[model samples]
Target: HAVVDTTGAGDLYAAGVLFGLSRGAAPDHAARLGSIAAAEVISHLGARPRMDLVAVAKSILG
Candidate 1:
């Protein structure tokens, strides 16, 4: 993804990881979710999820 900025990627990544872990995912899965969140943020100009994060994670994780 094209990163317009890197300011909030870390926060988003952490959110993803935390969410995954909270959802009972393994470390690898949590990290993958974190990466997915970071990538999604980097793909656009903002730090927010343009799509629903749960849905995105489910789709990606699934």
Candidate 2:
């Protein structure tokens, strides 16, 4: 995603990382999750998730 702005990137990334860790993912895997979440956040204007993150994470992890 382009970095037009980096408003909530870190928070989203942290959310993803924590979500992954809660699911028992490895640290590396968790980082990947954070990347995914941050990507979602930075893709648009706000920090809001366009899609359901839990479902998205489940789909990706599964």
Candidate 3:
């Protein structure tokens, strides 16, 4: 795993998990959301990008 930065990935993943829980998603689903969000950050060369995660989740869950 190439680490360019460890600034906000953890925070963003937490946020994603929280968001999923707030939306009434199951724990497993929330964890998956967090994992996906974290993966997005790690796959790139920066922290979580300035994107709308709610929109992404809506699209994904739809």
Query: Relative to the unseen true structure, what is the C-alpha lDDT of residue 36 in candidate 1, on a scale of 0 to 100?
Result: 83
Poorest 10 consecutive residues of model 3 by lDDT? 42-51
Considering every candidate listed, which one attains the maximal lDDT? 2
Residue 55: error of model 1 in Å? 0.6
Clashes of each: 0, 0, 0
Which pairs clash in the backbone of model 2? Answer: none
lDDT of 1: 0.83
TM-score of each: 0.83, 0.84, 0.72
Segments of candidate 2 deviating more than 4 angstroms:
none
lDDT, each prediction: 0.83, 0.85, 0.75
lDDT for model 3: 0.75
lDDT of 1 by residue, 1-62 (tens): 46777767899999999998888888999999998888788777777877688997787667
What residue pairs clash in candidate 3, if any at all? Answer: none
- The predictions' CA RMSDs to the true structure, in order, are 1.5, 1.3, 2.4
